[model samples]
Target: MRVLFTTWSSPSHLYPLVPMAWACRAAGHEVRFAGMPSAVPGIVGAGLTATAVGSDEELTGMSASGKLAAWHKQEQWPADWPEHPDRLSPAQVELLAALGRKQCVIAERMVDDLVAVVERWRPDLIVSDVSTFAGAVAGAVAGIPVVAQLWGSPGVLRYENRALGEEPLPEYAALFARFGLDAPVDPAALLDPCPPSMNLGSALPRLPMRFVPYNSAGEVPSWADDPAVRPRVCVTWGVTAAKVLGAAGLEPLRRIVTAVAGLGAEPVVAVTAAQRELLPALPDGTRVVESMPLQLLLPHCDAIVHQGGAGTALTAAAYGVPQLVVPQRPAPMLLADRLAATGAGRTLPHHVVAGDEHADKLVADALDALLTDPAHRDAAVRLAEENAAQPSPAELVPALAALAAR
Candidate 1:
């Protein structure tokens, strides 16, 4: 069988689909990943066949201007938008509509190219990141099955769609009409990697798969082998935050490093090369490593302090490490809340991290709790066990094949 995997241009989005793609390949199926040109490097880096479908210039320009980051700020959104969708004021409804239009615009740019690829390649199945609407369109156009893959979030997009009464925005409806297809072609199945305890209930036909962390591979540092004289804490703000939010994003990193240091724990700052140059001077004893994958770093650490990215939070949970999440956006905030509810982690809102006069003390206090508390560790271990118990990607290959065969 030929399988086409699709996602948007972000590596975080692409990474979640890799394990399943690899599973298909191991089962002797032909696989190709389609995305914007910017995603090619990540697709290739994961050792998958790449099929670049659309231009990256628009996304690149948005990131450079910080417009993309600005859209992600949680403060601009109504606090009750998720729970109280019916009670939304006119302005709040407009805000939600605007966000939907933005997504539709991005989806529109890729649909033509994705549809063309579907016609030429004629894959039996298309596995897509949950946010990649173009994949659903292409699958509908070609009359093939599409499987939606979640990136360890609590199905936020699904929740939002339900809240919106499952109606497509006008922009989305127009995009579908252009191709002579119906709006909102539901996927045949959802491949969820989030553990059952961490997952919010979803009405979709869900297939539980283990999250095998595949943040691009890197060389393990020599220091990683040495025994720690003090408790080692991993501090990271993830790749997207620093690039989109600029200096404002790095400020939390500074506070986290200070907080870890103040508590007499070693701060292992994991960063990209660009982020390394932008960071301010750190206190002595801080170990700064560039381009190191968290999978390699998290196992040895006592705890983690980071931006509440799904990949980071889930990876730490898989390793059974306690977490202190400093979240800037609603998605991450939701992930942090869910993680905290599981008794495995805690959340610190970006407002408090950036605005509190004693932000370092607050962070220190939280990090200190994660380090000293035995309950956090015990809960983390249980979460890890639950994660490990899910069906492996290899086990799910037959189910996917059956869907395509149907």
Candidate 2:
């Protein structure tokens, strides 16, 4: 069988779909990844076939100028977002509607090009990132079965449902009509990577796919290879957070480093060169490297302190490393709540973050609690056991092939 995978232009969006594509290829099936022009290089670099489509000059330009992150940070709800999503304030409803509208704009950019590719390729199965509705539009036009890969946050989908009745999606009804489909969009299945304890209790059809960490590739260093003499903790932030918080975002990450360093455990701060520029000083015994493959680093760590990006959080869970989630954005708070539920971690509210007058002390206190407590470590092990039971992406391929055949 031939499979075509499509995703949004962002690295956060594209990286989630990579392991699954590799799984399909290893199964002796032909696979191709299609994305907007800016995303194709990443797809090709990952050793997958790249089919570039559409243009991301506008989104790319916004990111380069830091306008996109600033926009996202303003609408971000911190703590109350996990409240009953069905009954939200008009302002909250408006925020959800605005998010959907923006996605539709991005979707519009790719759908036409995606449809053109689908027509020419005519693959047996179509797999797409849940947020990338362009792939759904194209697969519908091509009359093939489509599966939505949930990078698996129930909070995200739960948040998405708020905008459902308010809009018909993409605000481009003509395209559905152009493709001869009656509904705006639909998928045959949703492959979710989140554990049940963490997922939103929605009615959408869901299939299980274990969370796998695929942090962008980096060269391994000699220091990383050496076994640590004491408990090692990782302090880091995702790219989205840096962009959203701008220079101030580094404050939260830096605070995490100082807090963890004082706890007598080793703190490894993984940052890119661009990110390192914002740092003022490093705490004693705290090592700050430009960056490293997180999957390689987490296995040796006792704990992780982060801004609660799903990729990093899920990766930490997979390795059974206890974590302190100092969430800076709306979505990370939800992920932090779910991680806290597992007893593997604790989520800090926005009040304890960068804007707080005593942010550093509060973070240090949290880090101390995570290290001194044994329960967090025990719970992390249990969560890891639970994930180990889920079928990996490779295990799910035959089922996908069966679905395609049906």
Candidate 3:
């Protein structure tokens, strides 16, 4: 079987699907990754066969300014949902559906190239990251089955076929016709990595896979292997936030670092090389380094403070490390909500921690609660156990094969 794996250009988004792609390859299926030129390197770096499908427009002279927050809206974030889209009012549904289209707009640029790839490669199956709509359309055009997988919360699930008041989102509906195919708003399957305790009930049937942490390749710092006598707290804001917020990310990172340091815990900040200057002067015992493998860092951590990227939060949860999430986007906010409810961590709104006068105190309080409380660690361990029990990506290969055969 030949399988095509598609993702938009974010490493965070692509990382979640890598394990499953590897599983397919390990099972003797030919797996090829297709995406924008920006995404091809990460795919190739992971040792997968990569086919670049579309060119990212350098058309605009802006350094990093295309669709900065497609699905990162604060209001549209699942602020209040009982895991049911039916619970929302018509107005809310319409509004959210619009945001959902914006979330998927990247696919519009890639569909033509993606469809051409499908025509040439003629894969038996196409598996895509949840946000990669072009692959679904291409699969529909190619008459091959497509399965969508999630890295985190179901931001897209809430808007499936939802009306937009007088102006509804005809995204997939119109999108399919544009390619001369009838698009099924839903996919053949939805794969999720969140533990059952953390997962909101999925409206669509879900295939749960254990999230194996995969950071393409990074050297483990010498300090990571050594144990610390004091409590070690890892602070990270993730790459998306740095790109979206630019120099402004410093304020939030300051609060996170300051709060953790105030507790006398040794703070290890993982940042990008460019992000190093943006960091505020650190407290005496804090160490800031660019690009440390999170999987290596998390196990040695007593607790982690992060902006809620699914990869970051899930990795921490998988390691049974208690987390304190300062959410930059709605998805992280949603993830934070689940973690807090599950007793594995705590969540603070970005505003509370970003330049608010009380930000330092508030963050310190949350960190203290996570640190001294045995319940947080116990719950994290429980979630880790649940995460481990989920079928591994390698184990999910037969199921994918069956889906394709069906």
Q: Rank the candidates by TM-score, best first.
A: 1, 2, 3
In candidate 1, what are the lDDT values of residues 1-406, reduced to their tens digit? 9999998766788888998999999999999999988888989998999988866666644544433445456653443245546776655465556556656666787889999999999999999988787888899888999998999886545422434657776676677778887666788999999888877665678999998988887888878889999999999988877777676679878878988998999999999998997897788999998989899999899999888889888899889999999887766876888789889998888888888898888898888889999999999999999999999999999999999999
Which pairs clash inside model 2?
none
Task: Please provide, for model 3 over 1-406, each residue's C-alpha lDDT reduced to its tens digit, 9 standing for 90 to 100.
Answer: 9999999765887888899999999999999999788888889888899888766665122223433333343533544363554566655555556545654566777888899999998999999987677877888887788889888663334433454222325775676789666555457888888888777765567898898987667877777778788899999988866665667866688778888888999999988787787777877878987777688778889999998888988899899999998885555777888888999999988877875898889999999988899999999999899899999999988888888998
lDDT per model vs. reference: 0.83, 0.76, 0.78
Alpha carbon deviation, residue 346, candidate 2 (Å): 0.7
Instruction: List CA RMSD, all candidates.
Output: 2.3, 2.7, 3.1
Write down the TM-score of every candidate: 0.94, 0.91, 0.91
The candidate maximizing lDDT is 1
lDDT of prediction 3? 0.78
**Best-to-worst lDDT order:** 1, 3, 2
RMSD (Cα, Å) of model 2: 2.7
Off by over 4 Å in 2: 60-83, 155-167, 170-175, 178-180
Candidate 2 vs. true structure, TM-score: 0.91
Tens-digit lDDT track for model 2 on 179-261?
67876656788888887767775455777888888876777777776888887898888776565455776876766777777
